[model samples]
Target chain A: MIVVEALSKQFGRFQAVDEISFEVQRGEVLGFLGPNGAGKSTTMKMLTCYLPPTSGNAEVNGFSINSQPLQVQEQIGYLPESAPSYNEMQVEEFLTFIGEVRGFSGTELRRKVGRVLELTSLQDARKQIIDTLSKGFRQRTCLAQSLIHDPPVLILDEPTDGLDPNQKHEVRELIRRMSEERTILISTHILEEVEAVCSRALIISEGRLVGLGTPDELLSQSIYRNAVTLSVSGKSAEALLEDLNGLEQVYSVERLEDMPSGALTVRVFPKDRESISSELEQFLKKKKMVIEQFFVERGRLDEVFRNLTLGN
Target chain B: MKGLFPIFKRELLAYFRSPVAYVFIIIFLAANAGCTFMLGNFYDSNQASLEVSFLFHPWLYLFLIPAVGMRLWAEERRSGTGELLLTLPVRTSVSVFGKFLAGWAFIAVALILTFPMIITVHYLGFPDNGPIITGYLGSFLMAGAYLAITSFTSALTKNQVISFILSVNICLILVLLGWGVLSEILNTIFPVWLTDVISQFSFTTHFDAIRRGVVDLRDIVYFLSIIIFMLMTNVVVLESKKAS
Candidate 1:
């Protein structure tokens, strides 16, 4: 649904988005992860035809951003970073205006407006002025505006930036539910959101593409991937650390702080990130170790995010 | 062009949606009445012609028209709604022309509200209706000319105050160029041909001719050319923002 080739934008002497290239397919939710000022919003602006690129090009629904921007705009439903809407307009009025601009009229425009209001759960606030609404409601209003046209591609910049946890969960659920047929490109700094809703994650830092893969693929790049963590009470901490470190499959064992119940906790590292769980379980049984808790880590996204975004 | 109607509708409704429209209309009517009755001495002159009332329009529009136009683009930029508006499947020229028409239509509404002045003139004596009708046409076109300049200045910055001040200064220069005192000063320092050429660009020169009921094509074209030139420049300014 979207293709970008060497898309670059430069403002004076500062390069906001460097020759970045990527593509998004239908039914895929791509998470745009970047540190602040990493050009995520800039890229989305180019894709939505809001900002023209300095060099290279991008296409949405096969319409080029440079030569066919109006057609490209027709294919996109963009939620700008600020989620801007007219403050003086009522919620229903705003959506109706957007619907009309999107080429719907009469009963169809009203139906489109009503559908988006219900989709965004903005039914009760329909008649209220936007300036009087809360931030989450305002965000939802903007979201509803984007959805009014029912475009196949959605480009949302920080869609959940100011929402509370429950609102965030609802928006994520909304994105997840909508991902069955549409191509979504959402820019956010929240790692958990990518894991929860996005089918693929693209991480950029310093205006450069650093990593692109699925959440699991990116997590596997972390140092903690597939590592086993065990809490034992029968053996001394020092003895267990030495014994765990001596196994052929184990590369190292770092002793962690004791649990609240006074059981010693340690993280066991595999030699090659392969599963040493079965072999270690047999070894523990032979050693007569009393295990309090034992589990293999699925890897922490924050660790992977920090490692990828924070310069090596 | 398909996008023009929706944008124009939204912008015009946006004016009435806030207190700006009512306050602007009230202040405009009150000020026009105050100028015509108190300052221009409409009753004492005993002239059935609306010359006294029409005399103050250029001066009134100097500040009033800019007040109506300054928010056309500056508010959009400040509130970040320009991104939303431009990203719609609309051409940039369509949005620009539509927005300018909406502001022009708003000033038309304000102009139409001054109908009682005509009723007053009709009740008192036999006034030359030709000049009066032409005077209103000239005023409406002049308001559009001034509004186009304000729209250009508004696109230059996101600050409404700056946009208001810039357009006021530009409109002041155009107004002063044809004023008697300024042209007299220019006559002493420059050649008559040069002075004529400079004042020809002034709003007062063309508007004054139309106010006298001439309805000359040259005068109408002058006001329309200003509107078209300024609106085209406004479109360029907005498009440049995307590149720079």
Candidate 2:
């Protein structure tokens, strides 16, 4: 439902977003992962028709952001970074104003407002001034405004930023619940949010697109993928490390720190993307080594994100 | 155009929902009344017309109109609400016109609340309704022209104070350009034709012409053109923010 074609935005000599191209299909939640000032907000602004790209363009629901901005805006709902809103307005009044601006009026407007307030769980704070509400409620109010029109496409810039853990979880749950019907592109620095909510992840750094794939696919790029870690108590650390390295299936082995209880932990790297845990287990059993703990690493997103976005 | 009504309605209501509209109206009435009675000496002038009252409008609007208009775009830009507003399915012109009309309507409300001045003048003497009515039309149009300039200045920056100061200075120059003493001083320094042309560009000249009951098409066009020009420039300023 969204196609970004070599989109580039330049502010004077600094290139904010440079030749970035990606597409998001319906029923897909694409997590935009980037560090601070990685042009993530810039890209989302261009997609939402708030900022004009200097060289290239984007399309939402087949409407070009450059030539058909109004039509594109009509089809997309956007939540800007920091979740800005009018502080003087009440929660319900603010949502109602947004609903009116979105072309709903009369009973339909009230129903839409009510539905979004419920969706964001802001019904209790309906008549309360937004300025007096807590940060979580204010963020939810802004979220409610974005969802008032029920647009098919949502572009949220840091939807969970500045929220507490529980609020973040609730927002992720809301996004997940809505993901089945809408195309969502959320930019966030939190890797766990991407893992919990996104079907595909796109990583960018320094205005360049570096990694794009499913969470598992991106994690596979990490060095720790398919690696085995074991904690032994009876064997000497050096001997176990040497023995684990001698095996043909084992690529290398490193002795991890000794635990407080005097147990030694070691990580074994496999020669390929295959299970080495069983082989290591058999080798330890033959060596009369007491294995206390063993598990295979399924890879980590943070490690993958760091590897892709490092040195930027 | 499609987004005009909602935008206008929201902006208009926003004023009343806060202390801005009430405080502005109260201060405006007090200052206008003070100017007429204390400074212009309305009772002492022994005039049957509201000319004494109309004379202070140009000066009163220098600060009052900017107060009403400085937040038009500056607050939106500062609070990042412009991002939400512009992203709506509306043309830039719609927001520009809608916001301008809202501020103009708000100043209209403040102006209408000064009805006691009219009642006092009529009760005290048989005032000529022609100049009184034209005086009000001239004041309303002048307020719009001043507000358009404030809106334009407001869009130039996100600081409301800076917007207010810049527009006040601009309006001050426009007022001084056509004031009697200023024009006489300039006439001594420059040629007669040059002083005449300079004075013609001043808002005071056109507003004064309208207040005197002449209602010339040129004077009406002058106020309207300034409003249009400033609002058009306001749109350009906002649109350029996206490119930069």
Candidate 3:
């Protein structure tokens, strides 16, 4: 439901966001992965119409950001980074203000505010002043403000930062809950979050679009993809290594450890999308070698992300 | 216009919710009464008109108006709420005008509280209330003009102190342009027409014109033009900053 085309933003000599283009379909939760100053926020700002792109443009729900900003804004709920809020206001007051400004009135305004407070789990702290709230509650309040209008599109920048593990899980669950029917785009430096909730993700670095695909697609690009680990007991390490080396579809087997309990651990790399698990299991059964641990490894995107973003 | 009520109500409530409105009003009343009684010699002059009470308005607004207006946009920028406010469905002009009106209304409340001075004068002597009424009108309009200027300066930076000082300096210049001593010297150093033109733009001259009991439409227009001009510039400044 969001189309960002060749969007670029520059602050004088510094280019904050280079030409980046991508689309997010309805019911998709797109994770924006980037390091600090990677232009992720800038790109989101352009889409939200908070910042005019230095060049190029974006469109939300078929309305061009440059020509129809208000229309575009009306459809998007933005939770900005740091979740800046009016510190002097109470939680309910701030949510009500947001609802009122969006043109909700009377029972409709009350219901909208009520829905958001429930969605964000902010009911207990509704009457508390914002400045007095703890950080997690404050963040939830900001999230409630964005969700108060129930807009179709949500652009949340670092929605789960600085929270403890439980609070982070709560916020992530909240985003997941909201992502069922809405097109949601979230920018986060937290790597695992992409895999946890996002159906697809876009990675940007140094103000440019560096990677874009599903979490699995990105993981498959990792150097560790499809590799398998073989650990066994009641076997001679050298003989097992030799037989594993001769197997088809197996490019290389690197022995990692020889345990005191007669256990052997070896990491086997496949050759070109091959699977040698069945043959290896059959050979072990023929020799009557006990299997301790055997499993194919999925690619680790953390490795891929570090390699891709840090390499540049 | 549609977004006006939310912004106006929020800002007005903000004023009362903080100590800023109460402290400012108390100080404003004190200064107005102090200037009238101590400096203007209310009893000594036996003056039926409220010339002394209104006299402090131009000077009072220099510090007080800026104090009220400095937080208008500067606080929003400092706390990063400017992005949230600007990105709302409301137009920029609506925010600017609504906020300006809130500050104007606060000052209007303070001015209205100066009724004791009027009551005192009425009890003391036979006074022409026409000139006193126009004087209040002049004070209210001049306060609005000062607030508009302060609001514009406040929009320029996130620093409230800088906003306060910059607006105070600008308002001071506008005030001095028509003060008797400054304009007298201007008439000598520059061409007489230049002094007249500069004095025409001063807060003092227009306010004094209204105090003379003649509510000339030109003087009213001049103050209004200043308010409108400053407000439009405030909108332009905010809009330009959004790009930068």
Candidate 4:
């Protein structure tokens, strides 16, 4: 549905988006993950034809952004970051104006406006002036304007920002429903949103694509190694650490704490699960340490993001 | 054209929904009426035509039209709605033309409200209606030319105050070019032909020609050319901004 190639945007000496290339398929929800000022919004603007790229090109639905911008614009609904809107206009009037500009008229325009209000759950605030609405309602009004045309692709930049938890959940559900028919590319820092709605994720750091895959696939790459923690009551932490360090499968063992009752919190780093669990069982038996709590810490998307972005 | 119609309707509605259009019309009419009747001695001068009323419009529009036109694109840029409007399916020229026509229509409404002066003149004596009609036409066209220039200036900046100041300064130069004070100064330094060419471009000169009951093609073409030229420049400015 969308193809961006070598898309780099520079404002004089500063590069906002640097040579980033990616493709989004139809009906796929792709999450663009990045920190603030990471060129996520810049990339979306190029796709929406709001800002021309300094170099390279982007295509939406087979139309070049430079050569056939109107055609591409006709097919994409863009909700820019923070969703700036005309505050003086009522919600319904704003949606109607957007519909008219997008080529809907009369009954079709009314129907489209009605459908978007329902989809964004903004029917109650339809008559209220946008500036009078709360922040959540105003953001939904921005979404309604974008959806009024019912375009095939949605470029939502931080759609759920500033919303209460309940409103965020409601918006996520709406995005999920919209995703059944439309191709969506959402840029967000919320990792849980990616896990809940996006089918694929693209992690960018310093204007470079660091990782791209499903959540589980990215987790399994061991960008975060499997590390287990054992709270044992029968042995001293120093003894446990010494014994665990002698095992072949154990990469390292450190005593996190030494309890007054002679218990210990030992953090064990292992190469893999199969090798470490069996080796630790045998090694702990020899050391006579009774394991109280033993659990392996799995890799979280947040950890992977921080590790990749902060490291780069 | 289809896209332009809706934009035109929306812009016109937006004008009325706010106090800007109403205040603009009221001030324009009150000033035009007061200057023509009280200041210019309309009835006491024993004039049987709209010459006094129409003659003061160039000075009125020099300031009034900018109030109507300064917010045309400047507000869009300030509110961040320019991106939403420009990225839509409609062409840039359509939006530009639609906004220009909306401002022109409001000016026309204000011109129509000056009908009381027309009625009062006709009530007193038999005035030549030919010059009156042509004068109204010339005034409306001249107002359109000023509006087009203001609209172009509005697109250059996001601050409405800056747009208003810039437009008033430019319009003031255009209005004063043919006057004796400015022309006399120029006549001493330049050739007579050059001075005439410069003075002929003044909106006051063309408006004065039409006010005399003479519908010269050259005067009409001058007003039309200024309107078209400014509007085309408006379109080109917006298009080039979008390109970069």
Q: Least accurate stretch of 10 residues (summed lDDT) in model 4 chain A?
A: A217-226
Q: What DockQ does model 3 achieve?
A: 0.69
Give the alpha carbon lDDT tens digit for every residue of A1-312 in model 4: 999899988877888888999998888999999888888988898898877888899888899998898899999998878787877788999899888877788899899999999998888889998888998998889888888888899999999988899999999998998898888999998999998899899988877788899876666655335677778886545666777787778777767765555568877878653336666777777767688778676657887888778873
Tens-digit per-residue lDDT, B82-137, candidate 4 = 87777777777888999999999988888898888888888999999999999999
Ranking by TM-score: 1, 2, 3, 4
User: How do these models rank on DockQ, best leading?
Assistant: 1, 2, 3, 4
lDDT of 2 by residue, A1-312 (tens): 999999999999999899999999999999999889889999999998888999887889999999999999999889999788988889998898888877889999999999998898888899999889988888888888889999899999889877899889999999999999999999998998888999999999989999999998998877788898878888667777777788998887877887677888888888876678788888889988887788899888888888888963
Model 4 residue B61 lDDT score = 92
Q: List the residue pairs that clash in candidate 2.
A: none
Best by TM-score: 1
DockQ of 2: 0.80
lDDT of 3 by residue, A47-93 (tens): 88878899998888899999998898899999889898889899999
The second chain of candidate 4 has a TM-score of 0.97
Error of 2 at A78 (Å): 0.2
Measured with C-alpha atoms, the lDDT of residue B130 in candidate 2 is 96
Candidate 3, B156-243: lDDT as tens digits: 9999999999999999999999999998888789999999999998999999888778899999999999999999999999988878
Is model 4 an incorrect, acceptable, medium or high docking prediction? medium
CA RMSD of each candidate after superposition: 1.2, 1.5, 2.0, 2.9
The candidate 3 chain B region of ten consecutive residues with least summed lDDT is B46-55
Q: Tell me which residue pairs clash in candidate 4.
A: none
Top candidate, metric lDDT: 1
| Tens-place lDDT digits, model 1, residues A1-312 | 899999998989899888999999999999999889999999998898888899999889899999999888888999999999999989999998888777889998988888999899999999999999999999999999889889899999999989999999999999999989999999998899999999999998877899999999988887788899998888777887888888999988988889999999999988877888899899999999898889997778888878887988
Better of 1 and 4 by lDDT: 1
